[model samples]
Target: MDKTAGEYHFTRLETVVFGAGKVESLGRELSRRGSNRALIVTGKTLGRSKLLDKVKSAAGSALAGVFTGAEQHVPSHTVNELVAEARRVGADSMVSFGGGSPIDTVKNAAWQLMGGRAGSRTIDFSAGAAESGRGGDILHIAIPTTLSAGEFTPGGGVTNESTKVKGGVADPRLQAKVVILDPALTIETPAWLWASTGMRALDHAVEGSYSTRHQLVTDTLATKAIELLNAHLLPSLQMHGDDELEHRMRCQLAAWLSIFGMSNTRGGISHALGHQIGPMWNVPHGVTSCITLPHVMRFMAEVAADRFGPIAQGFDLRFDPRSPRSSAVECADRIAKFIGKFEVPTRLRDVGVPREEISRIAGTVLEEVKRANTVGVEVTLEQLVGILDAAY
Candidate 1:
C-alpha cells in the first residue's frame, strides 16, 4: 500500500491537552488564545450534569454565557440561535462541551459568526467558501466527553430541521484551536454511550484506512487507532478499577488518531449512509454505525477487499492475502462481534426503524451518493436495501 503520489492535508487544530484533570486549564487556554469573552455551548441534559459545573468553574470569568440549545443531529435552527447568542454575548471565542452535537453546532455556526468575510484562508469544500467566507476566523475550544471524534475534523454534519436532511460545513477555520481530552471530564458519560461512540471511532479508523483518498500517513494513524480501540475501549468501562481512567484516556487518544487526517480522507459509505440514517430516524451516530458498518463493509468487499487485511489484523484476526474477500468478511465479522459486546442497538429494527423505511433510506442515500460522487464504490438502491435488511 505504498503510494508515492498523494497529498497529506492537516487541519487547523494546534493544541491538545491530554490526561486527567486537564479541564482545569480551560481558562488558561482561553487566555492563551487572547479570548476574553467565550460562550459555553452544550446539549440540554449535560447542562444539568456536574460536568458542566466543572467546565464553568474552569472557564471562570472568561465565560460570557452558556447556551444549551445544542441538540442531537445539529439542527439548523439551533445553530441559528447559537449564532445569535455568540453575537449577543460579544464573545471572542466559544467552547464546545459534550459530544459530537455540540462540537458540530459550534463549527456550523462559525460560518455565520465569521460572516464569510474572514474565511479567505479557504475551505477544502467550496460550500465553506460560500457560507463561511475567508479568514478573520475565531476558533473555539472543544472539550469532548464522548469518543465520537467529530471534534478532530473541520467538517460537521448539520440536519435541516424542516426536512431532516443532513448537510455539512467544512471550513478549516472552524476546527478547534484547542482540544482538551481529560478523562476526568468523561467519568459521568453513560457506559452505553461511551461504548457506542467507541464504535464510531472504530468506524472512522476502518473507513479511513480504505478510503479512496487513503494515504500512507493516515493509514498508519488509522490502523493504530483501530488496534488501540480494540484493546482499550471496553476496558474503559471497568466498574471497579483505577485502570478505568487510564483506559478511557487511551480510548480518547485512539479517537483522535482515528480522524487525524480527515481533511484529506472522508469516510466512505458506512459514514455516508449513517449521516442520513442517524438524523432521519433520530438514532445516535454511534448507534447507526453499530447498525450499518459491518454490512457496509461486507458489501464493499468485492471491490475493496484487499484493504481489509490491516483491519482484520488490527483485531488480532488472521488475514489471508490469497483470499481477500473472505478476509474482508472476517474483518466485518470481527467488527460485528465487537459491537455486540456492547449493549447498544445493533439492528435498524432494534432502534425503531421500520422495515418500510428501508426503501426511503436507500433512496435518500442514493441521492447523497449522486451528490457527493466519492463513495469509493458505486452502489445501487438494491444493494443498500440488502445491507439494511441484513442489519435489520
Candidate 2:
C-alpha cells in the first residue's frame, strides 16, 4: 500500500521486550544502560509487591532508593517530591514499576530532571506542541504492571494540584530507554482495575484506527490489537493460577500494539472525555474510558463508519458495511456488554458522577483536552454535555 504524505514521519520507543518472565532481565538491562544508581518509582500498593522487591533485589547494589509515593493522577506536589528524592539519592537513572500513574510520575520527574519547569502556570494545550529537542541526560526504564499502554508513548499526564486538572507533557526525552513487559507482574493487579485498563487500551486501538491522522501502519496495528483484546481480555479477567500467564501476556501485547498505533495516530473522543472527567470525579482513568467509550463511538459513527466494520469483524460480529452506522452501534453495544461482565460500572452515576457535574465536566474538556484532538468532528461544549447526559 502506498503511504500517505507526511504519515511516515513518526517516532517510537527505543526497546520493547514482551514475554512472561522478561522482567527478571531488568537488572542486566539497567546495567547495560551504564547506570549503577537507580531510583525505583511506583505507587504505594505496588511498591510493596513481591515483584517490585524482586526488581530491587535484582538491581542489588545498582538500586539506590525506592520512592513509593506515586499517585493515580500525577499531582504537581507529588512530582516535586519525587524529583527531590531523585536528586537526594544522587540517582543516575530511574525505573517506573507499575501502571500509568507511576509511569507518568517517573516520566514527569525525568522531564524535570532534564530542566522542564512546573508551577502554578497551566499548560495551554492549544499552544503546547512537542519538540524533538534533547534535554539533560537521565536514562529511564518502564516496567508496566497494568495494560493502560502509557509505557509505550512519548506523552505523560500530570495533574496540577491547585486546579486539579490533568495536563500532558509531550517530549521524546520522556520515552523509556528500555521497557520490560512481564505478565508475571500483572497477576497482583486488582481484577477490576486490570480489566478496566485493558478496556482503555482497547479504546486506544479503536479510536486510533479511525483518527484523521491514521495511516496504513497504524491501522494494521490497531486492527490486530482489537482482535487480541476480543479473544483474550474477558478470559484474562476470569483466569487463575497457570492460565493467567498466557492471558496476561496477550493483554500486554494488545496494550503495546494499541499505543504503537496511537502514538502515530493519537486518540479521539473517549480519551478526551476521560481526561475531562477523571480529575473532577477522582474516577479511575480506565473507568472513565469504559463508561464514555461507547457513547463516543455512537457520536462519531457517522464519519467513522468505514473504520468500524473492521473492528466489528475483529470481534466476530456480523458486519455489513452497507449498514455501517448500525454495525458500529452493535460494536459499541457489544463492548459495553463485555465490560459489564466485570466489576466495572457501566453508567456515569454508577461511578458517582452526579447529573449537575456533567456540564462542568463538558466545560473542562472543551477548555482543556479537545484542542489536542484532530478528529475533524468539530465537537462543541453542548455535544460533550450530550455525551455526558447519555452516559449518565
TM-scores for every predicted model: 0.93, 0.94
Model 1 vs. true fold: TM: 0.93
Residue-wise C-alpha lDDT for candidate 2, range 19-132, written one tens digit per residue = 887877888888887899999999999877788887788677789999999998788778889999999999999999998998988878887888876652333322213554
Question: Candidate 1 clash total?
Answer: 8
Candidates in order: C-alpha RMSD to true structure: 3.1, 2.3
The lDDT of each candidate is 0.83, 0.79
The model with the greatest lDDT is 1
TM-score for candidate 2, residues paired by index: 0.94
- 47-152 per-residue lDDT for model 1 (tens digits): 9998899999999888899999999988888888998899899989989999999998898888677763222221134242233446577768999999998888
lDDT of 1 at 79: 85
